[model samples]
Target: MPETVLIVEDEFFIAMDLQLMLEGYGWRVMGPVGTVKDALLLLETELPSVALLDVNLGRELVTPVAEYLKAHDVPFAVATAYDRPEQYGGEVLAGVPNAGKPTDERRLMAALMQLTGR
Candidate 1:
């Protein structure tokens, strides 16, 4: 079975494009949810095999959502433009795989595949 991937990004067009891309690659795509609230709400009932998370959601940070995913043992990659670990709570996110903003489909898919051991 293809792996299921949850995507949490605030940018509307990017999110939709990612969804389509993942679907095209035969992976089941879940929410391109734009906020921590919505992403958390979706996490309440559905756990994707892996997740692609944006570090910032509008004015809010996605640390809480990342924490939740960690606790659940859900593998995830950070997708962001920022390079500072301080931007993500002082190295808490250091060494985590990053998909980077304006995501390169090849890199993103490779990161997710590595995380999922697929």
Candidate 2:
């Protein structure tokens, strides 16, 4: 099966662009959604080989989403503007690596590759 990815970013263009990028690499993407709620719902139905999560989903936090992935042993990485470890509630590396915003093709792909170890 093709590798699947769950995207938890809140920006439309970013998500769309990421989808295109991942698709180009032959990855199946589950979401590029704008809300934490939407991401959670998608998780209930399916799982990806890796996840790309943003730290903030509008007013809500993405920590719970990160927490969920860790609990399930599903590998994931984070992309956020906030660089400090505290901003992520000190969860960086628990399962999520820090991939900042304005992410490029190589950086995002490298992070995803690390998370998948593929």
Candidate 3:
């Protein structure tokens, strides 16, 4: 079965583009969800194989969602426009992979592929 990927990005266009790209590669995309609350709500019902998390969700950070995913053993890649992760103040994200926004499909795919061993 194709793995499902939850997308937690605040930007609508970027999320939609990512959904299309992942779907094109035969992935089941769970969401292009814009907020941490909505993403967490979905998480309560569905467990995705992996997640693509944007560092910032408007004024909020994705650190809490990342923590939930980590505790559940769900792999995730951080997608962000920021060059430095220190600005986010999450030590848990220290060694996690990054997918960098305006995301490059190759890098994103590669990161997810590596995470899932696909």
Candidate 4:
């Protein structure tokens, strides 16, 4: 079975772009969910092999989702415009792999591979 990836991003275009890219690479994509509530709801149903999270989701932060994923042992990477997402996400994101915004394909794929060990 193809590995599944959960994507937590608020921006519509960026989420669509990421969905297309990951699908093109032959992996199953779970969500490009925009909120912590949605992400957690999805997680309750199924766990992805890895996840990609955007640090900020409008008025809310992605920290709670990150914490949930961490506790579940689900590996994930952050996609952010910030040079240091940890500043916003706190210690939960200290050493987590980051796939910077504008979403470079190479870096994104590398982070995925690192997370999945594939």
Candidate 5:
């Protein structure tokens, strides 16, 4: 089966772009959920093989979602404009791979591949 990736990002265009890119790479994309609440809702039903999270989701932080993923042993990386996501997300996000803003396809894919053991 193809690997699944859940995407948690707020920006509409960026989220869609990621969906397209991941699909192109033959991975099943779960979501580009815009809020922590929505992301959590999705997680309750199904767990993706890996996840890509945006550190800041509008006024909310992605920390809660990250915490859930970590607790479940689901691997994930952050995509953020911030140079240091840990500054915004606190210690839970420290040392996690960051794909950065504007989404470097190569780096993001590398991190995802590593996380999923693909």
Candidate 6:
């Protein structure tokens, strides 16, 4: 089976673009979900091989969701428009892989491929 990827970006257009791009490469895209609460709910049943996480989910930070993924050993990468991760203060995000927002699709695909070894 193809590697499954969960997209946790909050922006509708951005997330949709990512999802479409991943799907184009034959990856199974799980979500383009837009909040901490929704991410958690998605986590309840959908466990993907890799996750693309947005640091800020609308108003809520993704630190909690990161913690959940970490505990479960599900590899994830943070995608954010922010430069300094220190500003977020999420314990779970320390040393985790990340990609900047407004990132190119090929680069994002490469990151996800590296994470999933595909």
Which candidate ranks first by TM-score, i.e. highest?
4
Ranking by lDDT: 4, 5, 3, 1, 6, 2
> Which tens-of-lDDT digit does each residue in 25-114 have in candidate 2?
999999888787888898899877889887777787787777777788889887776767444455544545666798888888889888
Highest lDDT model number: 4
Summed backbone clashes in each candidate are 0, 0, 0, 0, 0, 0
Question: In model 5, which residue pairs have backbone atoms overlapping below 3 Å?
Answer: none
TM-scores for every candidate against the unseen true structure: 0.91, 0.90, 0.94, 0.97, 0.95, 0.91
Q: Score candidate 2 by TM-score against the native.
A: 0.90
lDDT of 1: 0.85
Write model 3 residue lDDT over 29-102, tens digit each, in one string. Answer: 99889888999999999999999999988899998898999999999888887776546938767777788888
Off by over 4 Å in 2: 88-95
Which ranking of candidates, highest TM-score first? 4, 5, 3, 1, 6, 2
Model 3 scores worst on lDDT over the 10 consecutive residues at: 84-93
lDDT, residue 99, model 6: 74
Q: What tens-digit string does per-residue lDDT give for candidate 6 at 1-118?
A: 9888889988999999888888998989887799888888999997889898988876888888888888899998878766665479366776666677887887787777678776
Local distance difference test, each candidate = 0.85, 0.81, 0.88, 0.93, 0.91, 0.82
lDDT of 1 by residue, 1-105 (tens): 888898999999999988998999998988989999999999999999999888888898888888888889998888888776436633556667888788888
Candidate 4 lDDT by residue in tens digits, 1-118:
9999999999999999999999999989988899999999999999999999999999999999999999999999999988888899888988898999988789999999999888
Model 3: clashing residue pairs? none
Worst 10 residues of 4 by lDDT: 82-91
lDDT of 3: 0.88
Location of the lowest summed lDDT over 10 successive residues in candidate 6: 89-98
